[model samples]
Target: MNPKVTDYISSNIKWQKELEIIRNVLLELPLEEDIKWGIPAYIYKKKNIMGLSAFKNYCGLWFHHGCFLKDEINILINAQKDKTKGMRQMRFISVDEIDTDIVKQYVLEAMANSEAGLEVKPKKNTNPVVIPEELNIQFSKNEKLKYKFNEFTLSKQREFCEYILSAKREATKQSRIEKIIPMILNKIGLNDKYRNC
Candidate 1:
């Protein structure tokens, strides 16, 4: 057992017992345990099989390649319906809901899937970039901003455009535009910082 995962389980106030139960069950298998992105991930054949996490309303079991699971009971959910394609989550609201038998079965199936080369590929971001109305208005008023925006590649431009378009409220759209102006002028992609890291 990884000490970090142990500490992670013990330190979690909301889902400590739940995490430990799931951990104990998974530990019985061949999966190597490790912390990835601050969550306890189970690995097999050097690939991530599943991750366990606690959310505000529920604790979740994240199957990295869950799209391959049979999901006969139909519990898996794509958290982000439109955006999430490959990853799926099985949510649990209470300790009693953590059926060890079902979990073990699912995990074993996931391992088999991994061994057989079953997989889901991430879809490439090839959709045409639609510059939000707000951003076009900014370009109209500020030629320098337009010039800077044009400096980035299409992908980067699309990222910024999508970022603004994702905001729900009018004020939020304006706020997003204001935020990206400096980034655009500095020739920074919206996700450059994280992507570089």
Candidate 2:
């Protein structure tokens, strides 16, 4: 067992027992236990099989490639159905809801699926760059900003686009664009502040 995972479970005030029950069940499988995303992630053949976590309302397991699992029993739930394609979760509000034998069956099935090479293809970001109208106008008028924005990677450009477009109000969007123009001129990514030193 990962000591971090053990500590995480024991430290949970609301779902400690529920988390421990799921952890104990997962530990019995062939999957290697490791800590990932600050939770217990089980792996087989170095591929993520499942991860255990405690949410505010529920404790559950996220099956990494769960889209490929045959849900004849229909135990899986698409937590983000529209956005999440490859992953699925099984949530439990109480420890009694965790049927250990059934969970073992699902775990074994996930292992088999992994062994069979079933997988979800990664989603491609295929849409063209979504430059806001204000930013586009600015880009056309300011040659330096235009040159710097064009010099940025596709991801960096998309990051700026998403940041500006995520604003709900037109004024907010304009304000965001104005705020980022200097950063663009400095050739900085929108997430530069959060990047590691």
Candidate 3:
């Protein structure tokens, strides 16, 4: 067991028992502890294998390969609605809610999946709008904004541009552009400011 992670989890009584149970189960596996998304994440090799966290009403045992796992326990929850094929979550309302046998099976399967090299299907691109001429004009006018936008990686630029052009109405598109211009100028990528670094 990792002393740092155990110490962190020990502070929360409700989560302590749950973490202890999970830690005991995964004892034989090669594991490391790190903080990810502000939660305690467990890694196998270099891949994120699982995470333990508490929510408002439940504690979560998240599987990084959950979307691919055959959930015999039927306790897994699809946490992300926008993405169809990545990282499923298993929520436990209480320590009693966990099925230790099933969780161990899942951990073993996840390790095997990692060894076999499986990846989630990438999300499809749904937006089809081209960049507006007016937006291009605005970008051209602000040299700093243009430079900042250029400094962003292709994927990051695509995210901001897609967000602006994806709106159904011209008014909404303009509104989004207005809201995002300062973010672009500040060299912050979409979702970067909100995500815990």
Encode model 3's per-residue lDDT on 3-37: one tens digit a residue. Answer: 66676677767677777777677776677777677
Best by lDDT: 1
Tell how far residue 117 is off in model 2, in angstroms: 1.4
User: Per-prediction TM-score, please?
Assistant: 0.69, 0.75, 0.72
For residues 1-197, write the lDDT of model 1, one tens digit per residue. 99988888888889888888888889999989988877888999999888898888888789978889999999999898787677889888888999999989999999999999887877678888899999999999999999999889988999999898889999999999999999999988898875542
Q: Cα miss at 85, model 1 (Å)?
A: 3.4
Alpha carbon lDDT of each predicted model? 0.88, 0.86, 0.76
- Angstrom error at residue 190, model 3: 1.7
TM-score of 1: 0.69
Model 2 is weakest, by summed lDDT over 10 consecutive residues, at 188-197
RMSD of each: 4.1, 4.0, 3.9
Candidate 2 Cα misplacement greater than 4 A, ranges:
133-153, 174-197
Q: Which parts of model 1 have CA positions greater than 4 angstroms off?
A: 73-75, 78-83, 130-157, 168-171, 181-197
lDDT of 2 by residue, 100-193 (tens): 8878888888899999999887766878998889899998899899999999988889999999989999999989998999999998889876
Q: Mark the regions of model 3 whose C-alpha exceeds 4 Å error after superposition.
A: 1-20, 23-28, 121-129, 132-137, 165-179, 193-196
Candidate order by lDDT, highest to lowest? 1, 2, 3
lDDT of 3 at 3: 66
How well does candidate 1 score on lDDT at residue 197?
Answer: 26
